[model samples]
Target: MNMQRSMLAVLLASTIAMPAISAEQGGINAEQGITTAIPMPVANNAEADAQLSAEELAKQQAAEQAQKQLEAIIGASGLEGLGEQARNLAQQVLNETQAPLGFQYDVVDRLTPLWAPVALQNTLASALASLDDQQRELLQSTLNSRRLQNARSKELSAIADQDNRNYQDYISRLRQQPPAPARVALIKQLDEAMQFSALLSVTRSSVYPQLQAVLRNWQPPQDWQAGLQRDVTEFLLYVHRTTPNDELQRLAQAYREPVLQQWLAGVKKSLSRQAG
Candidate 1:
């Protein structure tokens, strides 16, 4: 009975050990399969990432190259100089007897000194001159208008300078005045004009309309009547010099006082006559 019990115990131990060994073998097979599959997926992902990075880098380099080329062109040939050349070309065209042909050849010859690469200069001249008769006329008209406008601007600048000196003199006198309300108002007006003039000289035409809007709705500081007259005078002078007739008329209409409105109308008429 004792021998049979010992043998049964040994049999149970072998059965348990067999299952443990089988489980170990199964685990080793699973680990090997995972290790082999992992590298292929990882390598594919790395290759895809590298390709995408290369494409993005290429796009960035292309954009930078385009920007550099544009800068080079603009630096070598300035817009203002080109505009002057166009103006000169238009004048030459006007003086030529031949309707179009002589003017075209003359422009090409004149611009050769200004633009490098004689071929490019000639090409541009021919392209510009190839416009239809109506387009040519329109270009001529615009050029003529610009020339006249530049002349008028010089004249207006001289007038404005003289007026500014007079305004400064007025301010000096007002400072010596006996504390009058009108004198105070005039000082304020002069200050506003000075500020507006600086803006007009530097800012673009598109922004000038917005300035007029603000000026139209502006109100004088309260209890400062004596210091505001100069300010009003300066503001009006600036508007007369810079603002168009249509805008000035609109401003005149917006003012409640009939006298101020009439004054603004007179200013518009004066500007028109001067421009003409």
Candidate 2:
């Protein structure tokens, strides 16, 4: 039984640790791709409680959150009460899924600074290589414009500042208000929501749509645009495939629950506008 559990952990870890390629600006790094190993058994020594950097602590918390979400989905049929066997199964799955991720993190940490720049350069070059010479030159010229770059930077900063202010206000309100079931549920759903938001951003910023608008005059091959869309969709599907189908269905249902809908109303409207 112990050996079986160990094998399961290795399989899950390896499956989730492989990074799926994404075309958009933000792609998953090692940290976001998976998570830490099965936590070492807590020790009584002070060394066991060594301080972690804020970023490391945040990643640890995120891993914990993912564990809770996965457990919730797996135990959905009997979530109100878990028997010992169910609890054990959940732990076994969690350990297996995250163990390989720990090794991946170490490798990525060592190599990222050395290879990330080259990888990014290659990705950009590959994208540009698909365009006709005139089209590629046109984009290169626009990107080189200092005024346009500055304008975009200022615009993005303003948007980020407003978002920060809004978030702070939300947090302040939560502190002042009494606890409610809906509020608690919303808090629990945050990590999943953020993942969804990331997916939305990737789809929204996809090169296929940009090319559709920019290359309207160029009349790029019909098959070329379709291929780009297919590639982007496949990448997104790969990320989603990490979760079991039943778990994904449960997550979708939970998002539609009243508590999440209330919080997500504004986001839904914004997404709809983008779609339109």
Candidate 3:
């Protein structure tokens, strides 16, 4: 199946029977956002009959907190109310600006209150569900700080108000200047810390089984999963391309904080485990 179709299937599996939630998506955005959850994969133990293991309790609590946080972020974003308007606004922004190539502008337009699928939301939950309270707190605080940093970057960069030609010209010049190797390395670090790739991977893996269960004779392209991965990667690169370099740097720096690095390592590991 094509990636968009695959995305649609994930959303279908998530919300088909569930009540339509208010357009609360995940993440915080200073024109950006983040989200997480996980609960199911805790290994069973010898103490199963006695009481909840500490790990089990922590994971359960983390999942509950993740669900609550997800709700809060979604409500704050008011993404549901802006459904069609987001598309219009994104297009309008691109029309006014010297739009970046690919899907970057669309990403900037929609990053806030990200209108992601329910399955994707669940994938995030599953990712964070393994953390303890301390880790979860770190996630909220770190993401909130990143949100502020993004807002600050937008304010300081003033790219929003710059003349279109000059803005595009600046990007052209910046493109000519090869980025510092460290900066490139840092950007790659942010990419891993962000968890978008892992979420996409795990969500796709989770969705395929649902598709098989839902549809009879669900023959698909042999390389369908790879196609889905390629599409998602390219699309996210497009999003990354539109992001201001300075802002991207800030995101990288924010996530490089030790606490987040430690927490996200576990989350990424969990999601990857599911994907495999």
Which candidate has the highest lDDT of all? 3
* Model 2 C-alpha lDDT per residue in residues 1-276, reported as the tens digit of each score: 011223322322322121222322322242433565555456632343453344456666665654443333222211111112122232343344453554434433332321233332223233333344455334434433453344334333433443366534643554466345543444334324323333333323332233334223433345743444433233223233234445444544544444233323433343334334
Error at 187, model 3, angstroms: 6.0
Off by over 4 Å in 3: 1-134, 146-189, 214-216, 242-246, 258-276
lDDT of 3: 0.45
Worst 10-residue lDDT window for candidate 3 reads 1-10
* Candidate with more favorable, higher TM-score: 1 or 3: 3
| Better model by lDDT: candidate 1 vs candidate 3 | 3
Candidate lDDT values, in order: 0.35, 0.35, 0.45
Ranking of candidates on lDDT, top first: 3, 2, 1
TM-scores, all candidates, are 0.20, 0.23, 0.40
Q: Residue 137 CA error for candidate 2 (Å)?
A: 2.5
Cα lDDT, model 1, residue 273: 34
Candidate closer to the true structure by TM-score (higher is better), 1 or 2: 2
